[model samples]
Target chain A: MVGTDTSELNAARAALVEALVRTGDEDRDAFRTVYRLTSAKLFGICLRICADRQGAEDVLHDVYLTIWNRAGAYQPGRASPISWLATIARNRAIDWRRRQARTRAVGVEDAEAVPDGAPAQDDALLAVEAHARLHHCLEGIESRQRAAIRSAFFGGLTYAELAVQAAVPLGTMKSWVRRGLLALRGCLDGDA
Target chain B: MATPDPDPDMTAAELALGVLDGDERAAALRRLVAEPGFAAEVEWWRDRLAALFADWPAVAAPAHLAARIEATLDRGAAGGAGGAANDNDHRWRTLAILASIAACVLLAVTTLLMLRPAPLPVRVPVTVTTPPPLIAAIAPTTKGAPIAAAYDRASGVVRIAGGVDVPAGRSAEVWAIRGTAAPRSLGLLPARGTARLAVPAALRGAMAAETVLAISIEPAGGSPTGLPTGPVVAAGKLSG
Candidate 1:
């Protein structure tokens, strides 16, 4: 399985970090290489949060522009390059979603009805151990909490919005997420 | 396990999860810039949780998108340089017009001196020199009208006029960007009213008519990092 190939993933991660560093030095070609290596995943992120191909495309453009401008700010020691890039993509997508929501009301009911299913079994970009550990830790949490956390992460829903969708009190939703995150952190740290 | 501090950690986790509403999110963002401990906590959450995205199926962007991005970058680079040049051209034309006016004044003075009697104190020849100070209107990107900035070339001081009400816990940071150069911080703008910021000696030479000045909303005492870490509220090119 691709996840089991630690050395290859580590090597790829190293190369991406190098490319990101080069991009920080304002190497346009390195930026292009970074784009080529990561754009698909970032585009997927944009598409999911934006829920529109055209808006995702525009958000993707802004994400790259921001990456180009903020590459120097990337701290490789603190986080993996893919995680850092994904964070930027996710934030930009969320911002786009928020702006769109302001212009036209989004159907909270429609979004809430979407099922929180198990993540499909496929090749993932994260390290095998890390991925396995996360899933294992997730398993320890309540199913509702896990589902809420997953929905929050993937759907970019605020606590109020998630509460409204789940037909639960806002404070209850917040408590579930807070407890879930604390538990997840404890488990992850314990393993280390 | 040590008992976790609920409130701050929960806030950080909420921020990292992108679940905070507008006001709460803004407050968290401010803390991210102002408090190192808070920022680190937020980063810790983000780093761990980022793995959740690994399952997202990668969708290939359209083939044309790469080309489009390259073209956009090219245009951005070219546009930046071209905008600076255009501002410079406009400055020179203004200077020429000013010089012509000075020339006419000089001619009038000379003619008056020539026509006056010798008893009139002999005046030195008037020389038309020194370009007018460069001025730029720094327009806010988010809202409100533009702020006027007047740059004195001789003094190397930029006087900014027009009030911008920075939120209680934030300060406005000034940044200067020349053609193709990264944005350099010009220090923090005052919380309210007009202020003068001196151009650094190293950057003074680069502060031409084409230079672009921007103000970004930052944490109190300005951005902890030298580079701006917040939204650029206002920006404009310098012109004489």
Candidate 2:
């Protein structure tokens, strides 16, 4: 079970909480520590969703700025600190991509470029380490809907974008994701 | 009732899912700020969907960005002329304490969960793949029965079957050769009956038309060295 295997993520989560707590207090050293530990994860999220490295880089800038500004708003027990940070990074990237949806589309050619060869290893912190129940629930859905939801979640693609990309009607894409989401919520809440 | 209008809860889910755009997203974000209940609902969705972020492969932000961010922050702090954070805020201290306590509790709870016995796997969707078009009828150079090999492209599984018998204590190892290059071991084939060998991801691309798939009988447990050591038994070229 993924639940049993979260020791490493939890340990990282624990350290992140300490760093973030100090960061909330405006401790520059702690903020630097937080960035050192997490920039790669946030950058990775931005790069995958945006696909354009430069756009992702721009979004990464906004992400850290928001993180530094909103570190005080994070509620520890309500969500893991890493999840909280990831949500911010992903949302920022999504917002950036959506704003660029019409005028500038992401280039698959840009995405194909070799990622920086530097040691970007997330130290085992970036994998889906927690949420065994959610993993189980996600597994129970149809592959197409599961795939749609996965794409929406990771790529932050809108229903229109998803439909256009998959060459399906907008309504079909919407139904696939919304129904998948509804089923997923039932599966999750049933466990809780 | 026929309309696709979603309720507030679903709207919150969509907002948290990051699937909304234009006016719909704007309204959701407005509601997120105006209504506490709506905000909580969005938070719930965000927390759950954040699980999918697990697959976000870590890419290091260019090193200079952090320094630049700090510089901009420092300038903003100095120029905004606003009071910086005051440590006297009771909420700040409380949050820091909660964070420290949560850290310890998280470690202990995770350890307890790990020690518990494994639960059964939940039912997941099975992706049934059709048999691949590329196949080879590997026949012996001399006189012997032929082994059929069908490569499934999507799954990288090569099904081998011919009902051929193997000599006692000998293994039929499969090798894939491209051009004049040396043979790469595609793992050992089953001694008898039908078996599926998962071609390694690196070798899956090698199973193209005109590529030769060969089998050899070696000491049990296949080749000790990387290259084939025993005599070749059968060989055939894969064709689309």
Clashing pairs in 1: none
* Count of steric clashes across candidates, in order: 0, 0
Least well predicted 10-residue stretch by lDDT in candidate 1 chain A = A111-120
DockQ of each: 0.21, 0.17
Tens digits of lDDT, candidate 1, B20-111: 87557656755654455675677567767777767666889878878877766676665431322222343334333333323221122222
Per-residue C-alpha lDDT of model 1 across residues A96-172, encoded as one tens digit per residue: 67655655676565344333344434533465566667777988988888878887888788898789878988877
TM-score of chain B in each prediction:
0.48, 0.44
For model 1 the local lDDT of residue B25 reads 67
Which has the greatest lDDT? Answer: 1
**How does each model score on lDDT?**
0.68, 0.64
Question: Number of the top candidate by TM-score?
Answer: 1
* Candidate 2 lDDT tens digits, B1-240: 244565224787887776776556656644643354665566567667766656567787898989877876786565221111221133233333333323221122222333446779966557644544689999876798777888888777778886344567556678777644446667666545787766654455567888788776544444432335456668888998
